[model samples]
Target chain A: ARPRVGYYFTGKTGSQVLTDKIKKLQVKDFQSIPVVVAENVSVYDAIVTMFLEDVGTLFVVDQGSILVGVLSRKDLLRTSIGKQELSTIPVNIIMTRMPNITMCEREDSLIDVAQKLIEKQIDALPVVKLTEKGIEVIGRITKTNMTKALVSLAIDGLV
Target chain B: ARPRVGYYFTGKTGSQVLTDKIKKLQVKDFQSIPVVVAENVSVYDAIVTMFLEDVGTLFVVDQGSILVGVLSRKDLLRTSIGKQELSTIPVNIIMTRMPNITMCEREDSLIDVAQKLIEKQIDALPVVKLTEKGIEVIGRITKTNMTKALVSLAIDGLV
Candidate 1:
């Protein structure tokens, strides 16, 4: 018979220990309530919503809050300062469309999500779950959230 | 005399080898020319600069390019949407001040810079070098840059 082993028993500062902790973390543990906007919303309204929500990124959802697209501050800033009028422009025109957006599920590992964020060079990801209808956005995982987790781990001397 | 040994002699995945390579990198190798703006510039002008530079964060510098403060897209968005007039308002009032800004030197480790970025919850860090005059803004290291490095390593099977 083989003996069962504990993961954390290795040296405290070992990278394996930190890697294990990150892998064990679920996206739901750190994801925040997603700030969403409908695709048809005017760019002006979208800007106001962004400022009001205090979030740099906004998830564009459908009538049932199903993920459709993603909009960022750069998108709005570029559109606003461009020749087009903000009042008449809809977010759908500037948003990164679906089937191209990178997403994560609630059960996704934190390490995997972090990799996606880095690889994609994006600020946030919609934490979604597959359903009978389609993908439903339940929460959001951002660089800030990952940073918070890392900082907490550091402060606790667990990293 | 101690026997000479190599760090990569152990049989590890190419990704692990790349991870080791990244851990040894310094901030200077990854930093890029910083996008900067004057403190007295109007908020509208700053937005234009950001758009032109294609950067979300702009380092606020004084005469001789001395580091003073930092400005982010969120800051501009909030200030512009507020009661204050963007045309008349200056960036100094809204920028994060000197004493509170997190900075790094060229000699700093990449891992340290990454930790600082995560810990401070900021998108970028002003990679500064101490000069006879004062701290000079040599370059900047952003999350996007770091992401690019990570992605490159991953592609090379070194992550």
Candidate 2:
């Protein structure tokens, strides 16, 4: 029979156990609905969609809904202030393209994704699924989600 | 003498210990340097300042460095797409003015600020000090800082 005591023996310190629990958190568990824009959409329309969706970053998709690029508020703001008209400019020309976009899988650890965001200095990452055609944007994870994760841990121990 | 065992006897459980540690994290420990722009600066200059500073939010202040308003990338983007000239329009015309802004103090708990960020649907908060003159911007706390806190907790157990 186990001993009844104030502390339960788990072969790990309290902080170590806590670290393990947080490290196991997966991106799928906290990801948000991904807001996407078609590659051919004008920068103007994309901005409108961002406002309507109330998202900071947008995933750009091709006609087949294949991930092609990523658009951030900074990207749009830069173009908006440029000499060119926003409505006339397509998003593909200004967006961070596929090879340059940082992405993650739904099953990836939230900690790893957080590190990526910090290392890349990006605001968000698309939770993606690789298929026969191309990568599909299944969800979105941003610092907002990370902040919520912290709050949940403090409030509920992430149980 | 304390018992030598796999788990030392503490009144709190592992999760409770972790929760208490995180709940006690202060804004001053994780805050970033605030980037501010004069209220009289043009929207164009503000955008440039945001890019140069590499921050998503900028604090708006008066000549005496008293905080008067807040500017977010979303706020700037909306104004950028407007028909009006960016360079000619001042930031005060579009900023989220005082009394409507969400703020925090350096001594405030990080968890509380994270909750406020989620509740208000805002990305950043100005860490302010109330002086005889008015509010002064001392630091900036954003989702980025919260994310960093989460990462630190995982990597170092916040030790």
Candidate 3:
């Protein structure tokens, strides 16, 4: 079993817990809706559906719950922007391979977490924790939260 | 002047305008705070204070309000973890310089957003957009939003 999660709202605390706070960021806030596709999902259909749903990211998973890879709208858009016969392509080709994405536990902190994003340069992180059942994802944190917090704290005097 | 920021949760319609969702997965989230440091700030003290603040990411900006580069926790952690006693080491040395990190606008669809945390295997993404005044940060996308969305949609059926 994994540990329970914790949250650090900047409104309640000062900036002293920034590093540790990052450890607590999760995927729970803006996961959108799970649009899981099989490994053999057609790239053409994925891109078409991407726009239809107005979603920018897709998780490519297997019959099991284990994470296999992720596909971004940019990947499909970059590929299909001008192509006409690209719909039949499989998502595995463009999706980010697994073991490459970072997973966080529910109880991690958002503090000092900015370094991980800066190092990788990607926009989002996947939150997970190890358990007897395996790695279970609990939530997510988006840069949007940063923008909100920055503005909030700046107005509240942390700037 | 900056736009008037507001926090209004999007019910089942979702906050993201065009992003794919994770399936049956819960992830971690973070409250990404935007903190800036001057170009001349001491790298040594900056690293120390950043850790104490527990924020993994820091923005290095100029007085003109232009974001120049980003410094991550790993950048400083590497120095501290490796015993790189070069205390005077500048953040510019280890930072993942700008024009390399993928940035996005707040109004953009979360569905098609790139995975900044996944690529670097880090936890956050810095959000910046072009404006008349210069480049300004709007928000960050992290794993936490992803987790929450997954739980709400895939596991909880909120989506």
Among these predictions, the greatest TM-score belongs to 2
Interface RMSD of 1: 6.9
Docking class of 1: incorrect
Clashes of each: 3, 0, 115
| Top candidate, metric DockQ | 2
Tens digit of lDDT per residue, candidate 2, span B1-159?
877754456677778999999999999999999999999999999999999999999999998999999999999999999999999999999999978999999999999999999999999999999999899999999999999999999999994
Tens-digit per-residue lDDT, B21-109, candidate 3: 22112121322456767666666766655646645567777777677777765455334433344456666666666677666555544
For residues B1-159, write the lDDT of model 1, one tens digit per residue.
443632222454333433455566687877888999999999889998987887889999888778899998877776754666677888998999879999998888766787888766678999888888888888898766665444333243223
Comparing 1 with 2 on TM-score, the higher-scoring candidate is 2
What's the CA RMSD for each of the models?
Answer: 6.2, 1.7, 18.4
Model 2 per-residue lDDT tens digits across residues A45-154: 99999999999999999999999999999999999999998999999999999688999999999999999999999999999999999899999999999999999999
Estimate how well candidate 1 is docked, as a DockQ score.
0.17
lDDT of 3 by residue, A82-159 (tens): 333465678887788777766554444443343454455544555655666655444444454443333222233222
- Clash pairs detected, candidate 2: none
Candidate lDDT values, in order: 0.75, 0.94, 0.50
Which segments of model 3 are wrong by more than 4 Å?
A1-35, A81-84, A131-138, A151-159, B1-159
Q: After aligning candidate 1 to the native by TM-score, how far in Å is the CA of A58 from where it should be? A: 0.8
Alpha-carbon TM-score of each model against the true structure: 0.70, 0.96, 0.40
